[model samples]
Target: MFYSFIFILFFFNQVKTKSIVSINREANKIIKYVNNIPNNTWKAGFNFKSKQLKEIENIMGVLPINEKYTQSLEDLGFAIHHNSNNILDKDFNEIEVLPENFDASKQWSKCKSILSVKNQSNCGSCWALSTASVFSDRICIATNGSIDNNLSGEYLLSCCTGSCGRGCNGGHPEKAWKFIINNGICTGGDYGSNEGCQPYSIAPSAVELSFENTADTPECYHTCTNPHYTTPLQNDLYFASKVYTVKPKMKPIMYEIYKNGPVVAAMKTYEDFFHYKSGIYQYKTGSSKGDHAIKLIGWGEENGMLYWLAVNTWGTLWGMDGIFKIKRGSNECGIESRISGGLPKL
Candidate 1:
């Protein structure tokens, strides 16, 4: 009896230790660390604590924004460095008085796409989603709210081959913008809404937003995914007139969003960011994760700190109903580093 009792206690102890390790890997003990910070600007919670480490990595879905030229490309193919000198000239003079808090949705109340908060599901398609979102907004704004529609991120994810990078694994933000201008995309709504030419293939889920990168990027198709939708494939296509990367300065970025609606941006992600609940977020402490693309909608001041308002792809249940505010002007987490947007070919 004594031997059996000892064995039972040892087994339970081992199980306890394993459980602790799993939780740490999932949450990185971010809650404890974030709670300990003095005058914490943001609150931490178990937003992704139930997720596995691999799942968390999948959620941070953007490939490195700055990739080095590879010998493989030179050997098999050539890189296309589009001329940006003319496009960069499109930047407007510094606005004398920018609004304290300006939202694209509020500015363009007639453009319904501005109010959308999409979920990228378990796929690494943040690059495509943000690109499609910005394009949709720009289309509406450019056409004076006449062509209000959600362009298909699924088209970009599945059809934007080669330089755009792998669909679900990751993609480059600059290449994505270039793809929309070159190979136009069709309109599509969230998964299973059947509202457009090619709605997002990945189904929406409440609990499984950031599972491992198992969500399959659907095969590229020319026809509308929704059988009931009447728009022809070629007619459904929408193209951009111009695509360019905005300067990573606050003035340039603010001016772009103010004039052209939202712009897509890439930000370096850290483990602590998964637990973000509210307030102006600044990296407190955690291991650097990876790059993730997001849409910068506007800017505002909070508690003496200025922050850029951003939209996330992880669904409305997470992070201020799928939106967040990060410290602005300081390049916090490289949020101000790379911004890209385009004009819709209305």
Candidate 2:
């Protein structure tokens, strides 16, 4: 009996030692990766330290790089509902003097309407989340803080079918706005709440940062059928009418956010972006793999570096509390290229 027990203990110890060695090796690799990123102003470290090093690396590897724009916008699901002739003739022509500085989160403190940071999980729903976030904030601002409610990204992802693209595959912000203007969206909280028509199906906390990718895009459900929830009243439903693109310039983009609320921006993201922690992020290296949509809420200068304050949908744990600073003005990563938003009809 003593020999049998000794043999079992020895076997377990061997396994434990191997595991420790493997972990140490992965930790070293991550450290090396952080060190090797050229001219990175931001710091990169394990945000999810509780996870095994290998698991974290796997998570970093599998996180869906937004590759939705590779095909034509129509093929990617952006269907145009309105007439094309008068599309560019909309009210986005308003010109305003540029401010030296502005921060929406600080200005709207009483409303507390500026949304808390959100996570998109493993899905390619940044397009929907970014649009819904901007829509939610704009509705609150336009209504003088009375209509502050979190709109549903899941609704846009699933229901905004023709132009807004598919749930996990990818989507476009402009198409999402068009859907909001026409159909209207209900108020749904994050993953768990039954407050709105359709709450986000994926739980941010339950996401696995491993090699096996299990999250799948859900089907579009037009009606509010969640037994625990009901459709919001017509007055409670939010919609917009004047959707326009901000000219890809510093002054114009700044003016739109200052006058309205937040705007959705499409940015070219590289491998380096996945490791962002803090500091003004500029595309340092790595191949331009995909495009990501985010809400551009405000802009500021940090230590002489001007940066745009972007709220990401990767939850509060991913970037700097789910917020990232991109180098502004220079249009780094094509951020200024696709700045778009609309006035919320109060």
Candidate 3:
């Protein structure tokens, strides 16, 4: 009986050791698979271990690539008509001065108004996240860093309605700006934190398999009442006075970012974006995924490659510390197609 007990313990230990070895082997394969992409412009490494590799592509914080959504750009939620008053036509030569190079991260770092990078988790709410980020940055710039407040993407996700499109599933940045202009949004932090009017409902690391078929859009609410806890009244809400779209071109878009601070821009994303690590990202070859809205903060040149420095909603673990550089000048990935934002009303 004593020998049998010892054997049982030994057997369990061996089984556990074997399971660990198997997991390590699988992780090595995933890393090799990423490195093997032919002529890959960017590097890819493991953000998750082997056991989670099957879901690795989904865990990168991007919605799955869908051909149907890619075929129709309008379905991505960019408004067709923008307010003409806010349009900065080419005739306005005074505002068209493009510097040799520019980088907002460096320019605004001293003021502490540079927008903080955020994560969207499994929710397909990049539209709201991008808009809120730009809004937060603009408020800081407009106030000369005096009122640099972290605006709430959660308020936009759960409250912004009408033409803003459905929350989580997908939405438009311009429509979100309109919502903020019409109905103010309160301060909110990430999920699981009640620091604001309404924290993000979706928890981080909740991977969604597909945006089109599986993800459910959260219902919109007008108040900041969380079902789980009693919260104090939130009076830290802000609004925008004007929201407008920019023409999809290099000069105008650059001018907007240079003059007005960061603006939300929607661009085509691909399967390879999930594996991006470091390098100037020009779309190589991959299935064209749906559009993603990002905050276009600045631009610079690297080894003769002119790139746009955009802040992604994914956390700092992905890309160059939560930021990415895409080939500029040529409007790579249709990035220049849809750019829009507005001024903060103090």
Candidate 4:
């Protein structure tokens, strides 16, 4: 009996030691990767000091969006809706002289919703959040900054039933826009803000250094969550007249933003992207984490390296106050590959 007990203790001790070694290796890998980055192009730091690799994976809010499954606006025959003329033809007259730096928030300073940096909380609803944010920004800009309202991400997260993809698990940006055009989204704000009809149901990850706990998608509801909000569900909705995808090129994207407004873009995010603190980000060392969606508000050059300024949905605690820049023009992480925006129905 004594020998059996001794053997059991020894086996457990070996397992514990291996677990500790594994954790140390993961943490050290992050530190070493950061230290070895050349030219100081960007800064990185840890949001979650995780003991396991899976913990880090759960913090990311975007899923692998399959382009094969989601249909584009062109596929839906929106080209004719714009009078059969190329969508780009209408806006290029003033875009001949592209500025070195452009910010949509500054261009339309009265459109306060353009500057919002929202927290998707523990939900992997970045697909819904970024699309909804861009939709909200366009509405304000379309109305000449007369209607500065936040459209509900929670509404899209729950109600986009078909091709919009699964809520919290991630959805297709194109489908989300389609839903906005067809059904129109209601007004909502961040968690507990009560500024809109339905605030976000999921709370943020709680702290900067902790692993994210996953959340189930909230139940779809048409009525406003706030009792004080007297607007009916039908009356509160905002619609889009037309939606279009930008050609995957630097100049076209620049002209699109300069003529219209900010755009929602999807990029292939890496493990090192989560550690981004400041400066222009180029994928350094790390394996593919998955895809992420972000709002591109502007572009500028830092240290002679051009970058697109983007807003992330991980709250102000992550990145540079929920903002980060990726190396632009080169299609870094496929950032420029898939971009979409629309005009609002005022």
Number of the top lDDT candidate: 1
lDDT (tens digit, per residue) of candidate 2 on 1-346: 9999999999999986787677565545654676677765566655443233333322221122244542343353433222212323243355444555678877675445475676676667778888888888888887778877788888887787556666666767777777887888877768876756677887784433532353576777666645676544454467776676666777667767887778888887765576678778887655555778888989988778888988877777767888888889899998887877877776
Query: What do the candidate models score in CA lDDT, each in turn?
Result: 0.80, 0.69, 0.69, 0.78
What digit string (tens of lDDT, one per residue) describes model 3 on residues 1-346?
Answer: 9999999999999986786577566555544665676765566655433333333333222233234533333454434434334554645576545786887766776434354777786667888888887888888887777776667787787676445666776776767877888777776666676646666776665332322232345666666645543544345668887777777777777777887788888887765565578877876554655778888889888877788888888777778888888888898887887788888888
**Cα lDDT of model 4 by residue, 231-265, tens digit:** 98889999888776777788778777777788878
Q: Model 3: runs farther than 4 Å from truth?
A: 1-41, 47-96, 110-115, 206-221, 225-234
Least well predicted 10-residue stretch by lDDT in candidate 1: 76-85
Q: Weakest 10 consecutive residues, lDDT, candidate 3?
A: 56-65
Show model 4 residue runs off by greater than 4 Å: 1-25, 51-53, 56-75, 78-95, 208-213
Model 3 / residue 36 / CA error / Å: 6.8
lDDT of 1 at 161: 54
lDDT of 1 by residue, 249-271 (tens): 88778877887899888999887
- Per-residue error at 303 for model 2, in Å? 1.8
Off by over 4 Å in 1: 1-21, 24-28, 67-95, 206-210
Instruction: Tell me model 4's lDDT, rounded to 2 decimals.
Output: 0.78
Estimated TM-score for each candidate:
0.86, 0.75, 0.74, 0.86
- Local error of candidate 1 at 330, Å? 0.6
Q: How many residue pairs clash in each candidate?
A: 0, 8, 0, 0
